[model samples]
Target chain A: MAADRNAGTEPVVDMQNVSIRYGTDPEVLSDIRLSLEKGSFHFLTGKSGAGKTSLLSMMYLALKPSSGTVTVFGTNIGFASRDAMALMRRRIGVVFQDFRLLEHLSAYDNVAVPLKVRGMKESEIEKRVRELLRWVELESSMNKICSTLSGGEKQRVAIARAVINRPEILLADEPTGNVDDDIAQKLMKLFVEMNRLGTTVVIATHSQELINQYNYPRIHLENKSLKVFPALRRLSNAE
Target chain B: MQNKIKLNHVSELPLKKDQANLFLEAVTAVMVFLFSIALAGYMLVDSMAKNWQNGISGTLTVQIMPLPGDTDSQEKSLRLNKVITFFENQPAVESVILISETQKERLMSPWLGQDVDISALPLPELLDVHLKQGADFDYEKAAQALKEIAPFASIDNHNVWLHRLLDLASSIQTLALSVLWMVLAVGVFSIFYAVCTSLGIHGQIIEILHIMGAKDDYIARQYARRGFLIGLISGAIGTAAALSAFWWLHHSAVYLSAGLLGSLDISSGGWLLLLSLPLWAALLSTATSYWAVRRTLRKIM
Candidate 1:
């Protein structure tokens, strides 16, 4: 009930009266209403099993809510055709906590997957992937198998892969977990840069330090509902 | 150590143990082996039947048996000589040769043993007659003339019973071809299962691809390519094994002596046909994977 208003901007993500349940179980998320403005940065913070990942899943069009509708870029996620949903997903970038990289692929190959999916020319994909990996300091590990990489290195590779296509929306779930302070800071910097470049970014995490360290607005999920709060630091002119 | 794997842009040749199973490859090889053998057998049987048909239609067997009332050697020779003269005088008969007693005994040796003498036993004489190509000889008139010379003589026009041999060969050929079709179906189903298993193991990666905005066609094409390559390699190995078997069996008189596959020497053209099966196998596997993966992705995504 405490979700934010649309803020008079074109909404990139809009969820209205959404409630979800599996079979006869209790509703995990009940009557949640939220809208994400285009070109805005927001953080999602919640306790374990408070439906942080579930909300992100719905935003990416992977799951449909049981009762209500969720729309991405004005297309109803629950009602759109599969092909239409696929096109919508192409404009969104996702980074995961586990860094789901194919073990057989090298770092460069993993990042090139999206471009290859789009049917880009081999030379173009190769050049872009190389440039992105070089930016993430993974140029040395480009040819290394993903499974052999350290936790920090794998997450950086995941970040590079997510932003390769300059997606209009970006979602990261626990992007900074399982890494030291320096590595976490580096990953945060990458996300911050992606947001400044006009991508609507959403990050879901349990880290209070990140919330205290950054001035981004926060959406707190508790008891199957969401409440939005302005950041404690300097308020943005855009806000 | 990791082998160098060449990759193209559109294919997801996941060079990992989880993506491909050797069991699938082995099953494919066995199916292709069965298919190759069945096809080769059909060709061999069809060829033998044709040869026998040609030879039988162009020849006659005049069998002369002695009458019981006058069973003397003089009477037997008189009847045989007259029949030989009559056939020689006919314009349609190409050549006629009386099968000698020694040759008769040799023909019967398989049943009578090598040293057994059939001199005392009454045996009919056979006149092996060859007809000229395109000759229009009235076989009924020839039978009537032989009957007048000796009531016990009969003409065995091999063309009469040769139809039955052809029928048997045709039936066997049809059966072998049916078996080949069935084996191909089974091969396709096997590949379907293999591709499905690979997808099951890599569900997480598939979810990631879905997140990456890969369409259903793109994902399915990757599996199709994988299936095609696996089928080509496995089918080549299977065909090589089957051709080797054909060579070994062709040289062995014991196996080839029985049944419709008598004395087969595969032509170069036939060998070429056998070598091209890997391409067919690759295509079949590609189609099967395409259908199977589309179905699975529908259920998955």
Candidate 2:
């Protein structure tokens, strides 16, 4: 709630000369420097193995950057303790590329996990979980076990789970990959609505058509480096 | 302070939640209960052996020889009243019970044929001597005293047979104790194995809970709670079943052991001790859970 909603503030995410690698392997991300402001919508486009997942992992604090200073919400990530990282995680929601829904829980319980972890009372959890399930159009399938659900359903459930706690920042990796184009458009619209409500949204996708349709900034990954393109300029030039 | 919030996050049990864990908990309880009952039974056996040994520790028997004359008149007519008085007056002998001819003939009834007239047949006079608890009796001194009254009289100490019986009882008790120890060790190891499995399966869930700001104690509490429930159910079932089996065997042994069975009744205290099995099982399960969670959590963070 303390996050800036008005214009003219430091970016929510600021990375300078940051590089990430898996163990001692060659750098998967190189010299990445970027700034993402509050309430901004951005799409990350890259081919497979172009470090898109690795970069998103860094932003979500799943993996620490191998070099340079990476700050999330003006706090240096590398210096943060485990408790701090968990608190920071609460502020950010991530939709994994694999749609990592816990297989043993029902769809409703899976979505309710983040809320439960925050110690929300049962009644409040029920109300919020029901609302989020409806948002994902999964209200009818709330009691179904995740293992029995279809791929698109799983992706929606994962999205519902990530955003259920009303995170200030949401990062989605290939959220629409398993769904049809129509569903992909709907998910994109949901992200836009969240952005309008002051959530900083970053979506990693290879669908340029979906990216082009939205009037949002783009950060494209090519040869392990990130390139940003202005959203308003591109839209105006197209018109 | 911030750790409290994290604790709340990690406190939830892994995805399948309480029901599935209940099944495993019940299993653990049963095993521990069985283990406890076996231990109590062993204890009971040991107590019985001690009681028997105390009853027979320092008693001695003496067999008197028949007079060298007419065998028909050598029985009750040759009343050795002087020898009996002398033995009773001895300081080493606390009390002496003179065996009557009828009683001596009755004692030998099992080995000898029936219809033997006590007035016609010559039989040895048997003396039962009870020694004072702290008094040390020399066999040579007692024998010499008895021989001066009548030649051909021998004192039987009865130590050899008593020693063999005591040794047999002690060995049985030791065997039962060894068995009880083995079962307890197996129970502990079984719980350890189950805890290891739980850690392996729920490692990620534990990690997520950690990242959610859950403290080590919070997560461990969840696991311990599950284990406690399981141990309770399993321990109760196993203990009840074992008791039933023991009851059946005990009843059947009454006819087989020729009235010695009633003397070795499983005491109420023994039953009370056995009833603690479920509690022991619960404690064991929870302890195992706590140890596993702490060790695993440390490795993760």
Candidate 3:
């Protein structure tokens, strides 16, 4: 309920003229500006090396921008302390394309991680984790080791883990890149369901078919610049 | 029904159970074993040195040998009795026992043989003098007093051999302490290396946890706790092994040498120090892992 501030009231993520690079190499992202309103669903579409992951990294506070400010929840994290940044990251849940689930832990434990890190009580954590797993239709495989799950099942588990804390924002970097079309569609529905319940969702993908399949605003990355396609283009882009 | 499945508190806790931790624990155990040996050696030598000082520090021996060519048993007897009376008169002297001919033969039989004529060789008259406990007797004065009683008589306080034994004991103890220090250094470095390796192997799991809003301390604690637990268990085993070894070795030595080195048992303080090894090792391992985790995490974020 803390994030139930009116949709379009204040942006959840605001990146202002951000530029990022690793070491002495060329900037991966340059002069990139992006903003997403609360309770909105948006797709970050770009080619393989068009800096989509880099932009999402900035949004999650995993990478600092080189020469510009990145504000999350109305706070600039360009110079945030390590503790402050970690606290900020809890509000954002990320699902990597690789489904970075801990292979050693069972599905139930994998989803309980975000809550455990916050020192949640075990009873409360168990109830909440079971509930979230049930939402993803993974309650049957709750005890299965993450590595043993199918690609579709793993993606679902990742989603459940991301949204378990009811994060104000959810960022997925190509969540369906490794799954079949049937499974991808199901995963997309999970994201849409989360968005409908007031969680801002950002999915970065280069799959044009996925982009065209949905009617939502999109932020496209090209030549180090980010361009926004509002909801009207959803029909045009789909057609 | 599947709700009965075991769920860990944290998913990315560590590099999980692996041979890496087991190997590191073995290394730590070896270090603790070596340290315990060195400490036991140091304690045993120190205790022996103290005992030696106590025994020889308050005793003196006086000998009266006649001129080599002179055949004078009557003169020797008179001078020996005079020397005994001179010592018995001194307030510092607790008791002085004059050497009887039978005792002299018993001491000389090893070198001279049992059948040799005892009267054929000129042997010195000996006196054993014990000083009173807490007596501040002057050693040089006692020697001077004995020399005046008979020109051929001289006193030995056993200072030369005592000094040599004490010096050797101290050197051995110092070397043992140096070895203990080296073991500690190796223990710390090895623990640090093990923790860093675990962190590297579990890097992805750590990154996932980090992205999920896990603090650096929370991430570090996983490895730190494991490191501490391994070190503690191994250290305790190593300490126990060392103690048993020392006990067996001391008893074997006593058996082989016919009860020699019986004083090799570690004193109470030394036992306390040895028992503290596990705690010290655990603390060191925990601290090393904590720093390693913090440093590794900092490099990424």
Best-matching candidate per DockQ? 3
Model 3 over residues A18-59: C-alpha lDDT tens digits? Answer: 898889999888987777788878888888899988888888
TM-score of chain A of each: 0.91, 0.92, 0.89
Candidate 1 off by > 4 Å: A1-8, A79-81, A230-239, B1-16, B67-77, B81-123, B129-149, B157-160, B254-262
Give candidate 3's error at residue B266 in angstroms. Answer: 1.0
Candidate 1 collision pairs = none
The model with the greatest TM-score is 3
Model 1 CA lDDT for position B75? 72
Fraction of native Cα contacts kept in each candidate?
0.54, 0.14, 0.77
DockQ of each: 0.42, 0.19, 0.69
- Write candidate 3's Cα lDDT for B98-160 as tens digits: 777787887677677777767666777788888888888887887776676677888877767
Please provide, for model 2 over A21-92, each residue's C-alpha lDDT reduced to its tens digit, 9 standing for 90 to 100: 877888888999998887877888888999988787777776678898889988998888666776787788
Q: Flag the better candidate by lDDT, 1 or 2.
A: 1
DockQ of candidate 3 compared with the true complex:
0.69
The residue ranges of model 2 lying beyond 4 angstroms of the native Cα positions read: A1-27, A30-41, A58-88, A178-186, A189-198, A213-239, B1-37, B65-87, B90-94, B98-126, B133-181, B201-222, B255-262
> What TM-score is obtained for chain B in each of the predicted models?
0.80, 0.75, 0.80
Worst 10 residues of 3 chain B by lDDT: B255-264
Task: Name the docking class for model 1.
Answer: acceptable
RMSD (Cα, Å) for all candidates, in order, is 4.8, 6.4, 4.1
The lDDT values for all models are 0.82, 0.73, 0.82
